[model samples]
Target chain A: MKKLLLLLAIAAFCMPTWSADTKNLKYVDGTTLTIINKPQHDGNRLRRINTDKYPDLTSRVRHYLNMPTGMALRFRTNSPVIRAKWTTLDTLRHTNMASISEKGLDLYIKQDGKWLWAGFGNPKFEGTKHASTMINDMDTTMKECMLYLPTFMQVNSIEIGVAPDSRIESCGDIKRAPVVAMGSSYTHGSGTSRAGMAWPAQLSRMLGVDIANYGTSGQQKMEQFFADIICDTDADMFIFDCFSNPSPKEIHERFAPFVKKIRSKHPSTPLVFLETVDREWKNFDLKKRKFENDKEQAAREEIAKVIANDPNIYFFEPGLYTGTDHETSVDGTHPGDMGYQRAAINIAEKINATPALKKIIDAAKAKDCCKSPCKCPASKK
Target chain B: MKKLLLLLAIAAFCMPTWSADTKNLKYVDGTTLTIINKPQHDGNRLRRINTDKYPDLTSRVRHYLNMPTGMALRFRTNSPVIRAKWTTLDTLRHTNMASISEKGLDLYIKQDGKWLWAGFGNPKFEGTKHASTMINDMDTTMKECMLYLPTFMQVNSIEIGVAPDSRIESCGDIKRAPVVAMGSSYTHGSGTSRAGMAWPAQLSRMLGVDIANYGTSGQQKMEQFFADIICDTDADMFIFDCFSNPSPKEIHERFAPFVKKIRSKHPSTPLVFLETVDREWKNFDLKKRKFENDKEQAAREEIAKVIANDPNIYFFEPGLYTGTDHETSVDGTHPGDMGYQRAAINIAEKINATPALKKIIDAAKAKDCCKSPCKCPASKK
Candidate 1:
């Protein structure tokens, strides 16, 4: 008996000294928190088009089913790892989109005050299923972090996990009012390498604000459906880049109603309008060149009349997409990563320069998300 | 017979006016052509690490097998469409890379003096047989264009196709000198959304130059084998971003020798050395902070000595990555698309400003590849 006890003691001595302690984990609803690109929705069935009133159109307008395209959540955590549990309704069919789209959750954190991308929690399957993903090797001391929700998937609920003992809290200071973008496939993130490279996503990163992407591919005709949905949706700012999908007649007819309807609902919110980029072969193709020029002229005239009395509306006469060179687009129509980057920088600069939008930006800065000494180069710059 | 003729005539008349013409199909040895990232060798066996001498290390060094990490081709075609046929030796297991990386070809064209993203020639698989990939709808009038090679596959040979009447010519005035990048996975394009988003590819687009990405994933130990290979490889400029993989001790021991060897061989060739970015969570973790600072200091000291007397060599201290906020990285180590963009812009700007590089760039611009009225926003800007 004594010998057996001695053997047991020896076995115990050979074991590892430290133990992995499971702390009390906490769950936070992404919807209840400040999600960057998510609009105020009735549950996770967030709609860019009013699906409740136009239930018949839900199946036709597939984009409305897609979750907030570039939405992200900023948080503080002291865990060595971040685990997420989610219920995703749909996954993209395109191999490109499926690879980097909203089927996964992309994680970022404030490192030196700038948002640095960690890794993503890739999904395991394609449909509505309870799946979990995680970033396992995180620095335990990490405090400030951000989580980008799926770009093309409808997330029913998301639960973020830290060490049981560690806590996950909402980023209180960074209050992001929705910045709504209404446009065609370019705004819908068609050619982007990932959801985050969309112009709206880039603009959000630059401006440190939330964006609600209301991009409906091939369907941005400034139709009554979009106007009705966008006007009713709560937004701080509205940007229109739908010239690609609308014809001269449609622009002349429907553009004003869309703008006026939004103005009627949110009289105080800022509205920004942009003309389409000059076609890729505009110089070589005279017909295309003429079409592009005429379209811009018509768009400018329409926007001018809509904002004539409204001081809150701003019309930017199409110079922001200057980098639409040979490297900017993925297809003739949709902007790729570089195109998105250029457009975002151009648009963000214009928005920053606008008096009303600039005021909101200044107010956001005053919120002071990072109150402590910032070592981030962005802050220093 | 008359009724049959009538039916055939009806079918022909009803058919679409435009037909996909696969003529003037030329199988130019991609190696002989101005393939950007590929180093000239005995046929398509172009390698960054001289596999002949280090045959034992070939299998161990995985990234050396990755073809066209940043390889691109600049050409002019009026085919209205572009198709490619390649024999890819290896396909990445990762769905993202396999889907978009080596299995695809990214095409861009010179428009208004800037490179524009045209579209990709997506591969069509035929049970391991060499199948063709194509971009069906390009402007037949497109005079100048560029093509980026695969990132993760060893392309044995490639065949470029055009319309029978249209011709494919070299980018006549746009002579591209090789810009060689030596580093780890970041240079190998681990987290980039697409191959073109890699820093080397971006730099090539920005400068209108060829790039040879010799980015070895985790084998940047300043080994004699790599030094020998890099020394012999022809390059106009050399950029070293291998800091992520090398340890502090390795930096202290091998950094100077590596730089010195390259300097000895190509004394006039510009060498750019970089310090690593500040670790994402360095402030939060004291140990990590110390390690990062120490590693950077060691690397700086090594580079400083080598560049002290060499006016041709430029040492860039780490300040390029400012958006490290939480969005710049894929994991704690690799940079994602945004990070790559930030790094590329910084490096490109520095290379542009360097006296030696600026002269070369000026000379390339003087070549006047476009030779047309520049309307591209990049040129205008």
Candidate 2:
């Protein structure tokens, strides 16, 4: 008994103190938390679109809806360490993308009125289930935090974990309206290194506004269903990154009708169209160069006709999205982290310059402070 | 007999025009080519270090020597499409790095007196044997080109493929003395997206100088053998990225002697010691923060002592290698492509500022023309 007791004592000493203590951590449903950069869904916090309501949508669109591309959980916590336990729909891996950008979470902390990259939940390669400590050894002061969801992979379930003695609570609903963005892989964060480094996510941080990403990775062909989804959503503005994936014929056939569908519901809302980024490989590939040029030409013609009648419609021409050097892409198509960051900066500058869009962005920036009327301690500073 | 002959004619018509035509292409051994950015090896063009003379070197050092890192084949071709057939020693893949950076090749073409990214030989995932058409369908114009070798994997054999009618010839030897860089994975191009995007590779392109990469990843522990290799190599400048991998104790024990070994042979050569990059993750992880801090402190102390004694010795303090945003890394430890680019620019700036280094770099810039006395057509521009 004495020998056994000695061995047990030794074992207790060797074990990490936090292992047993972590059991005392409180668990909360992700649905109860404040979600940013997502359209209102039917109680499914993990999903970007309400699948039941959009049952008639294509299988690919329905599948991509569960990815939560620009969605994030907004909360306030005094926890020294932030942990996450989540299950991914598929442990997806891309040769050009970092694993963290595909299936892991990115944590940002609001420090001195700015959201800074604090930590990342690096997912494992073999399994769908993942558990990671996002950040640790932080001071136990109440901090406003945002945890960006995986850009490429869907999440089945997720639970934010904190220390036993700490508290985590929702930041409540954001009063400012979101800018709904619909597009293909460029907007879907394909080549970006981290989940939050996606262009839309970067824009949200830059403009201090919510931008709901409806990117479906080569599926944003300006279908009637996508237009219907965009029209149904309550948003301050709409941006289309719809030219890159679809055939030029598809653009000519669907462009006018797609705009009409959205304008029917919210006629005066700011509608922005992004010109397709010229692929770097097209510089050498003659066939691809012609193909991409035709698609852009078609998009420009369609946009010109639509904008002639619509007062609030705006067009953003391609402006050095990846710089003049043409070295920013991973696969000569989709933008990498540097490209995304550059695109976001250029796009944000365009948005800020437009009078109608700038008003909404400024309003959103004002509301980003705690409780609109500026009650938070940070506002005083 | 007529029917058989007709069938053969149809088969010949169906086959690609280049298939049989490529048989006429001249195969040149890599050693005979103008192999830039590599130290003198015992007739082995692919290796960074000559293992025959250094028989007592560590197995890891011997293995890492096979990776080409910053080496490139300088040649000129008028071929519309560039193709490559190569066999890798290992079909290495990292989740964070793009496949093209590890085992594939990157091609850059000189345009209007500047080297522009033209194409890449993207490696397949499953096999060691790889073949790829890097670029296609360009106007037949004589273009000066450089093909960067793989950063991580070893190349067993490689062949450059061109049009049957076109000629590929070496640019002759670079007249300027090369910069020999020694270090760990950062110098080895771990997190960079492409082989040519490695800092040393980028530096070469930026400064128009040959910077020989002697980065041996985790094995760069201030080994005496590495010091001996540095002493033996004919270089104008020597840079050590040797602080990142070694333990503080190992650094304290070996750093002074390592510098001494190099100084013994080439006392006047500009020897630069780089301070390790501050990893972004260390912001939250106190333990790692402390560990890295201690290592940097140790390196600084050792570097200070060496600099005090030797007038030619220089120490470069860590700058913002990955920018202030802290979102530039693929993993928090290794810098991504953007980080590498930033570091290269900063390091190049520091090198350019030093009068002793500036003289060597200016000489290199002058020699980058077709012939030493400004004979190239571009020099007139």
Which is the leading candidate under TM-score? Answer: 2
- Best by the lDDT measure: 2
In model 1, the Cα lDDT at residue B182 comes to 80
What overall lDDT goes with each candidate model?
Answer: 0.61, 0.78
* DockQ (0 to 1) for model 1: 0.15
TM match of model 2 to true structure: 0.87
- Once superposed on the true structure, which residue ranges of model 2 sit more than 4 Å away at CA? A1-32, A172-177, A369-381, B1-32, B51-59, B172-177, B369-381
Error of 1 at A328 (Å): 3.6
Q: Which structure among the candidates has the greatest DockQ?
A: 2
Query: Could you tell me the lDDT of residue B84 within candidate 1?
Result: 74
Clash-forming residue pairs, model 2: none
lDDT of model 2 at position B262: 85
lDDT of 1 by residue, A276-298 (tens): 76555443333444577777878
What DockQ values do the models have?
A: 0.15, 0.37
TM-score of 1: 0.76
Estimate, for each residue in A246-325, the C-alpha lDDT of model 2 and write its tens digit: 99999999999999999899989999999987688875555567788999899989999999998999999973277777
